[model samples]
Target: MNKKRLSEVIPLWKADKRNYVKKSTFSTYVLLVENHLLPYFGENYDVQEMDVQNFVLEKLENGLSQKTVKDILIVLKMILKFGAKNKWITYESFDIQYPTSRKSHQIEVLSRTHQKKVMSYIQEHFTFRNLGVYICLCSGMRIGEICALTWEDIDTDNGIINIRKTIQRIYVIEDGERKTELLIDTPKTKNSIREIPMSRDLLRMLKPFKKIVNPAFYVLTNDSKPTEPRTYRSYYKNLMRFLEIPDIKFHGLRHSFATRCIESKCDYKTVSVLLGHSNISTTLNLYVHPNLEQKKKAIDQMFKALK
Candidate 1:
């Protein structure tokens, strides 16, 4: 082996990685390396399985989500593998263990009444920003996607909202100086680039504006400059507070939309496609819990069939 510390090998690995991934993806990898990996293992040449397991435990104890810690491990493994391939360090595979938690994560969503109330309020007093929230409720578009949407992407004639791009602020480290930049990029996954038909009401609301709005302007701002997700999130939070609605994360809008669709007995595959999920299983997992009534009805139906 060339006997180089991990810090020495990281730059080489990053330079090679930059060519293969999207800018947003590369930024995410850089963050994982700088914030989680470097301080713990920067000077080390060889990281053992025990070291990684302990790191997983430490990160969990420090309140990182299991998913987040797993993401960090993936980045670490990739960097290590790259270093080993370059003969800069010896690579050993790591098998890390996580303590299984008994608690199930509950997805937050607005109650049907609250959803209607919010929608009604937005309809009664419409602004471009409020319109974004209404559109998310109707179409299940993510905040980033909605923020990046331009008037040109909305097909008023066809009553479809074309989802093509997403915007977020990403942290970047260049020449050892850390800074943030607003990045407008393609949706995270290819499946996320899709077309969602607008609700008839939504189409009617949008038609008049579409005729007058600048095609290049962002839908949320109705201007050339786009608002990034963070700022949009703050506006959403304040709107909820002002309306005396319980605060759920902004993503709850998307979840609320999906929940409504499932409740309406929309097919799982169609819901998944409309929500831009990579697969139907994701939609089912998120929104398909059976209530006690549903469970009892299913059992009754099964008994009747047997009889």
Candidate 2:
């Protein structure tokens, strides 16, 4: 069977995305095609709306997670977009409504006390193995950004860590055990590349571990092999266990670092820069939301000021 022409054209489109889009984004596009798409679409030489709609409806009826369905839909739309570009499929706004209901889960940041406790636990139980976790807790570096850190990127003398590249998970593959490809690439956006001022505490903590020369490309690695995010996370879980703390996602550290900075009266812009946020507005919206806690504080502070 001569594979559909779209199969041939898809690679070209992905190559375009890689060159024009961020590495993380390109990785996402590629995964959608490889895992969810190619498996099903490989048989469909010519894609049709009725076929796509039936597939989507079936996925919904089968009770797929909203997130999974959303991902599938996104890839489908992108593929249709590719087809339209090549005149294989006529372009039009989607006709049928997509299954919608599940709102994105809210990320609850650590309260001041909880954040402090977590930090204190990390500090007290700190080991060389978890030095990277400790640094991220204090510095608000994203997991990808920190994992991409190179020995040359850290400047102890200047008390700074240069933010250049990030390590992002692109896809899960089967090579016996489920595996994910980690691509070390540039930050999410131009603003994601910024110099973050390192705290003296972190600088001093890292001083001993700092290698004078690292032949391996990455600063964070084991046995000269680049460490995968999953293994790095296993160590974090062990650290939390040792400290008798509740297990939280690695991203919570980002929230904790941001909250601590706010509590310490670090300017929002500085915190934003420290986090390497592409936009200050995004930092405020996500990390600096004016929730019930802040609302109460605002009213209380206003009354106090009047008094």
Best by TM-score: 1
Name the candidate that leads on lDDT: 1
TM-score of each: 0.97, 0.74
Candidates' RMSD to native = 1.1, 5.0
Query: Looking at model 2, which ten-residue stretch has the lowest summed lDDT?
Result: 171-180
Candidate 2 ranges beyond 4 A from true positions: 1-12, 15-24, 38-72, 95-104, 108-126, 168-182, 207-224, 293-307
Alpha-carbon lDDT of model 2: 0.72
For model 1, state the Cα shift of residue 95 in Å.
Answer: 1.9
lDDT of each candidate versus the true structure: 0.94, 0.72
